[model samples]
Target chain A: MISVSMTVNGKAVSAKIDPRTLLVQFLRENLLLTGTHVGCDTSQCGACVVHVDGKAIKSCTTLAATCDGASVVTIEGLAHDGVLHPMQEAFRENHGLQCGFCTPGMIMSAIDIVNRKGHDLDEHTIREELEGNICRCTGYHNIVKSVAAGAHAMAGSK
Target chain B: MYAFAYQRPTTVRQVQSALGKHEDAKILAGGQTLLPTMKQRLASPSAVIDLGHVAGLSGIEKKGRNIVIGAMARHAEVATSEVVREAIPALAALAGGIGDPAVRNRGTIGGSVANNDPSADYPAALLALGATIVTNKRKIAADDFFQGMFTTALEEGEIITKVSFPVPAKAAYVKFPNPASRYAMVGVFVSKKGSDVKVAVTGASNEGVFRAAGLEAALKGKFNPKAVEGVAVDGSNFIADIHGSADYRANLVSVMTKRAVTKALGK
Candidate 1:
């Protein structure tokens, strides 16, 4: 087992984990942060999306060992007190999900898209940027709506 | 994934030492490809040496006439780098189009070239842009580096440190991606430097990424899409699969090349 230490969702964490343990496994098993889902462990589905050093990436494929000194943020890290994050609220308001299995990943990825593309996102850009996150529910029409609203909400909040 | 010892090295010298010590070691650049293979039990390396922490391995800068990218620079980084955008916008566009947003956030250009997947986009860019692969051992030109499918001139224990690409006058990459996997079904990269022109095709060849001499010769002086019109490429060497037949891919090669040259001209 390799000893690993890093900041997760504003918490400093250090644990003895198998050297081959994936970042998603560490988050779900070691820390019990299950919001980051693992729909396809092969990196095809973005159900394990999370922020490492402020950039969203697939956690299923990233080794926890390689992220020793980095700052990581997951779905659980997004909300403050009892209020949902703007993106999460936007999803709820816009009916962005049906099954809700891929919501955490979608919310995380949506935040990154907003961060990179800013609040003036178009439908086509939102559709193109969502190539990573796959939702079998809602046919992506409402998800795109949620992202656009969320981008505006995020801008308003700031 | 099988149990393995993990080694994180901070320097190129340390990478060499770790490789020398571990008999069956695999260098991990970005886990986008390697980790997935390991999860499926396809690769069972005894030791995994991560080059993430290695110094002097991740950045994009313009050096003289070439755009030099550190080996560990992520696709997202290259896609967004101002230097790459200014020096070679097509390269930035190519990097932006690889995989998805999350995969692009982690996948490195060096890893893509090292794996040399027949469907990868970088090899087409490397070959067409005339890139020089810089390793801890020595520099190998792109022409001498790619040997065959999933193969390269890299000896065991060698680590790619950087890649330097000559900034072409204009270039563009046109890729027809496999819908589900997003790996290129056929990718064409066309570039022109002065009067010299190059056309490279990836993902369609059974032999791996290769230059299309027929298309290059036609576009040498004219450097236009019309020059590539009605060009017949031999489809016998193309890999025929359910996604596309050899003839289909051969036809796509011409179409993509023509589109790329037209796009290059626009740039």
Candidate 2:
């Protein structure tokens, strides 16, 4: 077993995990942080999306040990003191989910995009960028709207 | 994923030693492709050496007339690097237009080139730009590097340290991506080095990335979009898959090639 240590949601966390254990498995199984979903293990689905050192990555494809001493932010970390992040609020307000299995990853990826691209996103660019995050529900119309709204909200604060 | 010993080496010498120590070891650069294969039980290495902690293997450097990119450099880094942008704008555009933001941040050039997935984008850029693959053992030209589908000239335990690409006078990449997977269904990279021109096509050929001699020859005669208008390549050498038929990919090769040339010419 490989001993791994990293900061998760601004908290230092450590675990002795198998070398083959994926970051998603470590988060869900070892750390008990299950807000990050695992839709497809093939890295095609962004259901396991999370921030590793402030950059979005597919947790299913990242090894737990590889993230040693790095910072990771997941869906569970998005809420602060009962206050939902603007992206989460927008997702909820816009009804950006159906099955909700892909919500966590979608929101994570959306927040990263907004953090990078900001509120100036167009419909086609959003569609193209969100290709990694698959949502079999809502047909992505509302998801796109939610991302736009969230970006607008964030831009206003900035 | 089978149980294996994992080690994160912090230096190149340590990486080389670890590789030499482990008999069936796999160097883990970006896990975008390898981990997925392992999850499917397709690859079960006895040891997985993580190169993430290797300090010097993750940056972009400009040396003389060449852009020396670390093998472990992520796509996003390359996409946004000032050196890459100034030296080869098309390369930055190609990197920026890879899978997605997340994949761009995680997938590394070494991982992509080492994996050599037929539909990958970096191989096309490397081949067309006449890049050299630097390994721990030796340097191999892009022409002789890619052996076959999901295969490379890298020997067992051979780790790719970096790739050096010549600064092209002008270059561009055009790809018709598979809508679902975001991998290139047929991608073309057109590059002009001095007076010589090279066109490399990926994601369409059965033997992986190969130069389009007809297009290259045409562009060599006249480095303009109009020069490649009447050139034709045998479409019999492309791979057919669920996303596109052989003929469809063949047709896309020509179209994408033309678009790439046009884009390179800024027309």
Give the poorly placed runs of model 1, Cα more than 4 Å off: none
Best by lDDT: 1
Error of 2 at B196 (Å): 0.4
- For model 1, the local distance difference test gives 0.94
lDDT of each: 0.94, 0.90
> What does candidate 1's lDDT look like per residue over B161-248, in tens digits?
9999999999999999988788899999999999889899999998999999999999995988998987779889898998999999
What's the TM-score of each model vs. the native? 0.99, 0.96
Candidate 1, A1-158: lDDT as tens digits = 98999999999999999999999999999999999999977887799999999999999999999999899999999999989999999999999999998999999999999999999899999999999899997899999999999999999888
Reference-based TM-score, model 1? 0.99
The TM-score of candidate 2 is: 0.96
Q: Pick the TM-score winner.
A: 1
Under the 3 Å rule for N, CA and C atoms, how many clashes does model 1 have?
0
